[model samples]
Target chain A: MTFTETLQTKKFIVTAELFPPKGTNLKPLLEKAELLRGRIDGFNVTDNQRAVMRLGSLAICSILQKQGLEPIMQMTCRDRNRIALESDLLSAAALGIENILILSGDHPSQGDHKEAKVVYDLDPVQLLKTARTLETGVDLAGKKLDGSPKFCLGAVVNPMAEQLDLQLAMVEKKIEAGAQFFQTQPVFEKKLLELFLCKTKDLPVKFLIGVFLLKNSQIAMFMKEKLGINIPDEYIKRLATAASPLDEGIKIAAELISAMKPQVQGVHIMALGLEEHIPEILNKVK
Target chain B: MIITKQKELDKILEKLKNRKNIFIVGCAACATKCATGGEDQVQALSVEMSKHGLAILGSMVLDTPCDIRVVKKDLARDDKAQKAESLVLLTCGAGVQAISSVLEDKELVPALDTMFLGTIERLGNFHQFCSLCGDCIIDETGGICPVTRCAKSLVNGPCGGALKGKCEVNSENDCAWITIYDKLKKNKTGIKKYHNIKNNAAVNKPQKVKTR
Candidate 1:
């Protein structure tokens, strides 16, 4: 089934991102894919997540497709330009990869290789426009191609921006750029997400609120201090004070999903390396 | 093409004493292809000179330094002419003369040595090919010119001085004639047209300097 169709069927559509292993062995990741196959509507295959090179996202999505799972292939503008981006999209369409999540990837400095040069030929907004242009068989420069590609182009938004007006402006721009759906950054403070959702309710796009599972108090604090992700003090205290951190984190995540179910269209759970406990979290919400 | 190594810039700058106005010019056509006379390379050079306490007047890039029309237009827009006592041409010798021909009162210097036309395999990697001998022989050799392939520019067969498919003198590279022969033979073609022929040895002449 198409990703949109499946989302229409499920009231609170739950999705997750699975990064392929860096090593040649795919047995572990394949097993994880199988575990979440029926539980989640679809899974997202990240394109070089955190800038650490893994197997290509297209290949992983193809593998997931063979496993009777719908895969959302995440495409980033970090490594490729308009030409290469369009070529990969056409290949994805030919391979029956329907769902796509576009992102302006992290800088090369954040990755293992700090010396690698970055090619930001087109930003995330431009990439969304390029995807729409590909539907008409033309490139960004208006050059016609042999065939066009069909894609459910999705974009990312950081709703936790310091300025609410700036964030709302970007949302309007993404909607104008042909972004059919948006998967936002982790929303720890439900109030902040509520404000963002209210401001963007008039946008003609679907919203999937992001939920990141915290392994422990230390990791949650690290994300707060290092990544500037505003995980509330109350949530951190709840997880830190629990006897079983995983169970506490899952309980809190399930609570969040249940609360946000009425506010948004879907939930994008980024368990990070905690794929095994996703079923536990899903079981609570379902 | 304009061939330039980073080390060559140091050698030329060593001769200059005081930092006056210095204008760096780059060629857009052949020099850009070789990457030496490109705008990015010229900007890098300009920044380096600025860091070394040299007064960089300005920098510019022309489409083709050898073209008379381009030379005239570049000279007309030379606002940096008053800052520098001389101009540094980051192009082939031919291009240097072309720039000098248009600006007779200014001193022109060669920032790069004119090398034979070639293609870049990767970054910081270069390989020479065409000598531009004023003739074309790509029709007979299955589109691979033996003149550029052969170490000795032999139009016939192997030079008998090849070892392990490599030129005996230059162990770093393969014998071009052997590669050409193998390519032609694999395509089931004959080399009878490339029989013994005698012609004057091509002389390595530097591009002529013209003064208007």
Candidate 2:
């Protein structure tokens, strides 16, 4: 089934993020996707994740679709103007890439290309609305398209954000803008997920809470300090003291997913270059 | 006011490689307040140029060099200014262009890079408050322009990266959306409307207007 069909039928949907290779070599990327071919509901192709230059997500998503894999193309507003964004959307449609996850990407300064110019011509909310508009057989300029694309649109949220009201407001805006599902930033503590679900329980949308695999205490610290994720010290301590940190990280992710399974509709796992261990983490989820 | 930063002396010298005699121009308004193009700065630049073996013909600090009338009235007819092979302008781009328009024959070189339209926080510190996108939407954002202040220029709301009221891209800057949310909450204003895509036609570059 397609990702949208899976979202509709599957009780506990699972999706994993895939970062396109920095170079033209797609062997490693395809190998990783092959590893989790049927394990998850969908493969979300990241668009230059963290603003690091990489092969474009559109090409990778198309390749995945050719290989009979459901690819959710992640689009960011950071690198393209309105014209390019709309054109890419139409191109994605023509390529038969259905699902789209729109994001207001990280500023270029945060990426490896610190000197790159940021083009956030369309805000994330506006991008989401634009996708919906294209689905209705019309472009943003009100011109009719020969063929429109249908998509299972998704957006992002930060459940542990201190600015809860603004986040919720944007959540509402995203839903209004045609976001059917939301994949959130990683929330380490179960209470944070519960708090977010409690606030968004009434909203008619699916929540795929972000579950990042913390490989070690240093990685956890980086997420806290650099990424600003709210990872509790308990998990970091567990990883720091454990003899096998990778095993411990897998255990922590599984434990969190098990705990979150009852509340959220799904889990979006971000293994971060350690995709080989995803099945090991999933094996321990029950 | 427009903010500016002085270019390195070496860069100016490189631009003035062939010219032996040079004249300096300064502005008394924004550039003067910014200390990039003031009377003191012009004198300092004159001395600096002289140390490089180039002769300084003359210098002038105009009231506002961005004004073509001021450029024509204060600098157009001066014998020393007219005699210089190159005119080094320690002013904003507008000021440099104004002088260029009036003194059409002179080879003009800008000694300062015009940074942005900003507000003066102190004598030396300046912060950009407007991007001059032409289409303004701060009315819905409680007067805090997310377009100008947000790192990603997200008009709808803050991106997920903001933490503890600080922007994820730069911790030194407060998250513009959070500040706007606070101000709106204080004023009991409702941010129910979602801002659509900004029209770029109004801000099409090399913008000009004819006021009636």
Candidate 3:
């Protein structure tokens, strides 16, 4: 079933992030997608994830759809202006891509091209609203489209963000702007996720808790220190002291998913380059 | 106020390598306040340049190099400025262009990089507060401009990256949207509607205005 159809059903929705290759060699990327072909509901093809330059996500999504797989096209406001952003959405719809995940995106300074110019002409919320506007057969400026595109719009949230009140307000704003579902930043702590869920329980939307597979303690440390992700020391300690770090990482992911599965609608696993180990992690989920 | 930063001495010399004699010009206004183009800076740069073996014809700090009339009346007829092969301007881009407009024959080199339109928190501490986008929405945002202050220039609200009221992009800077949220909440104001997408036409390149 499509991701939108899955979200409407009572089944637990599952999605995983899939990044395009840096160069024209798509063997590795396609191979990774084929491994998890039927395991997940949708493959979130990232648009230059973290501002790093790569092949366009829309093309990959089209390729995935042609291969009989559901692709969630991740759109960011970091690289494209309003005109290009709107045009890309139309192109996605024409190509039969249904799911869209809107993001404000990481600033260009954070990526490979530090000196690149940022074109956040439309903020994430504004982009979500613009996508909804496109469904009405007109563009942001009320320009007519020969045919409108339909989409199941998704957005991102930071459940572990320190400023809870501000984050909740923005979540509400995203909902009002036409975000039907949200995928949060990686959450290692149960309390943080519970608090976020409790606070936003009234909001009419689905929450897919972000579960990043921690390969080792060093990566965990980097994420905690550099990326500002709230990874508890316990998980880091487990990864550090474990006999096999990768297995321990999978266990941690499985444990988090199992514990939080009842509360959240789904889990969005971010394998970060360890896509092959995703099935192992999911197998441990019970 | 306009914030300015001095270009590297090597770069300045590189641009002036072809010119014979060089003249240094500074601004006494924002450049002075920013310590990039003040009289003291101009004098220091002049001494520093001479050490690199470039012939210095003369140096002067104008009251405002951005004012075309001021540059024309003050520096245009100066003997040293007229004789110099190139003028190394310590003022902002406005100053370089202003002097270039009147001294059409001489090569004008900008010594300082115009950083941003900002406010001075204290000496040597500056914060950019405006993008000069030509569209103002501070009234709806509790006087805080998300357009200029937010790292992403998000107008609808804060991006999810803000942590502990600090921007994820720059940890030192407080997230602009959080600050705006606090102010509006303190005033007991309901969360305002989305400001919508910014009108980029208002921020068209090489913007100009006729006050009259």
Candidate 4:
């Protein structure tokens, strides 16, 4: 079944965001995919996550689809212009890959290639519209395409944005841009998620709360400080003082997933190279 | 107006290091206001060139070097200009380009680097005001430009990296979005951000203007 059908089926969907390896040694990713094949409803493959060059998401998603898995191509506008992006979209559609998650990726300065030129030819909104436009058999330049991709379009949200009103505007804009669903920035605080969900309850889009397996307080702080993702003091306190950070982190993450199960359509687990921990955390969701 | 800075004397001398007869051109409008290609600046450069042991073929501070007609007509009358082997411009990039396009045979070297369309903040300080982006959204963005000001040029809103109302890229500068929000709040216009900027064909390059 298409990912759109899965979301509309009223069943709790489980998705995982995975990064492509930097090199051709796909054994690690293949093994992770093998482990995660049936476990996840869909796999969200990253395109050069953190702007560090990797195997292209198009290639990786194709690999996953061949393995009998539904891969959501997470495309960023940082690297490609409209022509290249449209070309890739048509090719991806031709390859039988269906789902796409669009994002305005992080700046290149934050990555290893500080000198690399960042091409934000079209921002996230434009990309979302382009995805929708292609489905209508028309490209960005208004030219009719021979064939178009039927994309199950998705976008991202930052639930903890300081200017919640502006952040809501982003969500509203994405919805207007033809995003069918949204996966959000990592949510560790249950209260914050509850508040955000309350504000956005009337919106038509289905939301998947972003939850990751936090290994330690140091990792939590790193995400908070370096990544600009907010981690509330309460959760940080628990991880900081716990004797076994991994256990505490897993427990907290599992607890968050359980708390949000009723509040959200699903949860997207960013396993952080600890794919095994995701299954373990799922076991604690009850 | 376009802002410019004079190129180093040694560099200008190095280009003239090979040529003997050199003519100088300066702009009276933008370059003069910025003290880059003004008459005084051009005269100062001429004195500096003579000190370097090269023939000063005379200089003319054009009313506007970017005006091709003025550039062609003014250079046409100067006796020393007709004899000069090469021309140096203390004007902005547009001026250098205009002269280059006009002077078919003579060598062209720029004596100033055009910076940006600047607003004079004060007597000696100039700040880049506009990015020359064709689609002017300052009307919607509370007269503050995220396209030019925001380090990421995000059209939607500030990036997650912004901290304490300051930009994530340069902490010293106030976040452009924050500044806009403050302006909108102060003016009671309501804080606004454009989720979808229309296709920017106007800003697409090789843009030309012909106002009748």
Candidate 5:
């Protein structure tokens, strides 16, 4: 079945993110894929996650699909211009990897070697629009592809931004660009999530709220202060007061999943070193 | 042009664990011009590995390894998977990973360290200019790199180590502060204007943060 069909069938679809290893060792990554197989609706393999070099996402996704797991290939515009990007899209379709998460990646400077040049030929919005164009057998510049790609296009959102209106505006723009689903950054506050959803009610896109497992209070604080994430102070205090910080963090995460269950279509558990805890989160939600 | 160095080559060989049957892979992409792990680099690696008594099974260089179609066709037609015990990649980390994505069983190794996205300084020299701090400071420095220029990455004037015309560390290269000073003066701009440029303290270093 197609990735979208699978997502629609699962009531509260669960997906996990896996990054290809930095070095040539694939045993660990393959082992991770085997562990996650059949447990989640689909797994996401990031494209050059954080702009640092690693294995390509399309190749990794292909490996996952070979293992009987559905793979969602994340495509970024940081490295490729329109020509290269569209070609890769067509290739993705040819390989039967249907789900795509379009993103205007972080600059090369944000990667391991600061000297990389960036090719921001098309931003995420433009890329989504280009994908639609490619579906019709045309390129971004209106040229024809030998054969077009059939893609289930997805985009990203940061709902925890300080400016709710601006974030909502971006959502609308993504929808206009033909994004069918959106996976947001980690959601720590239910109220803010509600506010974002309410504003985007008119958008015809499925929203997947990002639920990251907090390892400790330091990580929670890092999310808030450094990443501009909005976790309520009261929640932080509650986690701090708990007897076991790890257990408290899981409790808080479960509470978030419960709160957001009725609001969005699904929750994308970020696992983030707590892949084992996903079973716990899923068990609680079930 | 594909760019590579001996250090990167050493790392890839190290990953091979000194295996004998090796298939050296190259790319027709960015590395082709920099000449590090492109077609020539792969041939060079084959010979060098053979000198170390390693069996050079064969070599192939795709137009672009990241282009899935090219890689898929090449792998299918060549059937290097059957012949070579291990594959050594000379392209960027993306290219190496792309090849790995398709060939599930074969062992893949990276021959070059995928460093920063940089531009060629002259014909052969390449230098990094921006850090992509999510904030740009090019307007203040007159388009010359302060991030890579100043030894300390100082955004302001040259440090005490700046000499008459060259940097303190390397006399061969012009001092970054001197370049900035000359550029601003030539543009009839005040040096004070450049000092007020704020560094993006919040911008995290562009290293890979594995979010698995």
Candidate 6:
């Protein structure tokens, strides 16, 4: 089924963000995509995430489409100016890649090459607006195109953010920018989802709760430091004290899915390089 | 104002490895306030160079090193400056560039790294002011700079990673967008004050001005 059909018809949808290989080789990534063939509604091909240079997301998305799997192309505002972004969007659409997730990517300062000049020519809001505009027959400048691309536009959200009201306001704005769906940051508590869901209750956008699978207490603490995500102390304590962190992580993820599955449309598992462990997670989620 | 700090004494000495004569130029303005370039700093630097047996042609703390007219006149009249082979500029990047503009023949080495244009909260306290992106979005962001302050430079607001009102990259700082959001709300305002998104494209870099 198409991703939209899965969203509409199924009781719940499952998706994953695919981390492509760092090198030029696509065989490893293509093999991984083949491994996740039926496991998700669609896999989001990440752009040069964490500001690290990688195989381009559009290239992988196009190849993934040819391989008969639905791909959600993750595009960030860090690397491209307006023309490159608009051109890439159109090209991705032409190659039959449908889903597009827009983000204001991590700055180069945090990445390997601190000297790399950032080109945030379009803010995330502007990016969303541009994508929406392109979907209609004109570019961001309103120039006529031979054929505009149709895309299922998506944006990211942080439900667990301290500024709840501001997040709510932007939820309204993203919807205004023509975001059909939102894939949120990893959430650990119910109150956050409850508050965000209640606040955005009136909006038409679909919310996919992000489930970040922790490797261990070390990884958990590291993620908190790097991403500024506040992982619940209990989860950390559980990972910290567990006999096997991997096993405990799977158990916790399954429990989290069980707890949160009823509250939202679906979940997006961010295994964070633990793609091999996903089947175990899915197995226990039942 | 642009902020900078003194380069290490060892690093400075290493740069003067082969130089027999050197003239030090310090700024009395920003560099003095930052303690990077000042009268005492120049004197102390000269003393340190003396221990290494390097002959100091002379040193002066000019009130405004970046002012072309003042600096050009000051350098022209200074006898000690003319004798020196290397000019060690203990000032901001602008000061070094200003001196270089006139003293093109003199080999000049900057003794400090230029940090950022900032606002002085108080003595020894500084906050980044502007990135000079050319397209100003401060009015929309409640007088805070999303370009300079936001870790991701996200104008829209905080990214998904901001935790507890702090930035993702630097937690000590309140997220610029959050600050903007609160400030706008307190002012009974919103993003309507900001220009359209296309305006950001104006920063297509190699950004310059021909004030001439």
For model 6, how does the per-residue alpha-carbon lDDT over A1-286 read when each residue is reduced to its tens digit? 7676666674687788888788888876777777788887888889888888888899888888888888889999998899999999989988988789999898887788789887888878888888888878999788998998887888888898777777777776777877888898898777777888888877787888899888799988987776667678898999999999989998888888888877788888898777767778888885
Model 4, residue A194: C-alpha shift (Å): 2.4
- Scoring the B chain of model 4 against the true B chain gives a TM-score of 0.90
Question: Which regions of candidate 2 are displaced past 4 Å?
Answer: B186-189
Per-residue lDDT of candidate 2, residues A108-215 (tens digit): 997899998889999989999999999999998999999888888999998999877778888998999999999998889777777789999999999899999999
**What lDDT does model 1 reach?**
0.74
True contacts kept of each: 0.00, 0.84, 0.80, 0.18, 0.00, 0.55
DockQ score of each predicted structure, in the order shown: 0.02, 0.81, 0.73, 0.28, 0.02, 0.46
The global C-alpha lDDT for each of the candidates, from Candidate 1 onward, is: 0.74, 0.90, 0.90, 0.82, 0.73, 0.83
* lDDT, model 2, position A154: 96
Chain B TM-score of candidate number 5: 0.76
Better of 3 and 4 by DockQ: 3
Locate the minimum summed-lDDT window of 10 residues in model 3 chain B.
B186-195
What docking grade does candidate 5 earn?
incorrect
lDDT of 6 by residue, B1-212 (tens): 77898888889889888897799999999988887888988998889988998899999888899988878899747898988899889999889988998887888989988998878998689888688777886766778888788876777766756767777777798878877887888664474332357465467765667999
Residues A1-286 of candidate 5 have per-residue lDDT tens digits of 6578965664776788887888778887787777766677878888887678998998888888777788889998778866798888888888888889987665566578568765655656667877888899987556767867888889888777543443454566677778888888888877778888888877777888898888777877877765456778877787677788777777777888888887778878786645766666666663
Candidate 5 ranges with C-alpha deviation above 4 Å:
A238-244, B1-212
Interface-residue RMSD per candidate? Answer: 29.1, 1.1, 1.5, 2.7, 16.8, 2.4
Writing each residue's lDDT as its tens digit, candidate 1 over A121-231 gives 455666677788889888766788787888787877777755455345456666676778888788888788888888888877788889988888998998886566789
Clashing pairs in 3: none
lDDT of 6: 0.83
Better of 1 and 2 by lDDT: 2
The candidate that achieves the highest TM-score relative to the unseen native structure? 2
lDDT per residue for candidate 2 within B91-148, as digits (tens), equals 9999999988888988999999999998888989999889999899988888889999
Model 1 spans > 4 angstroms off? A7-10, B1-212
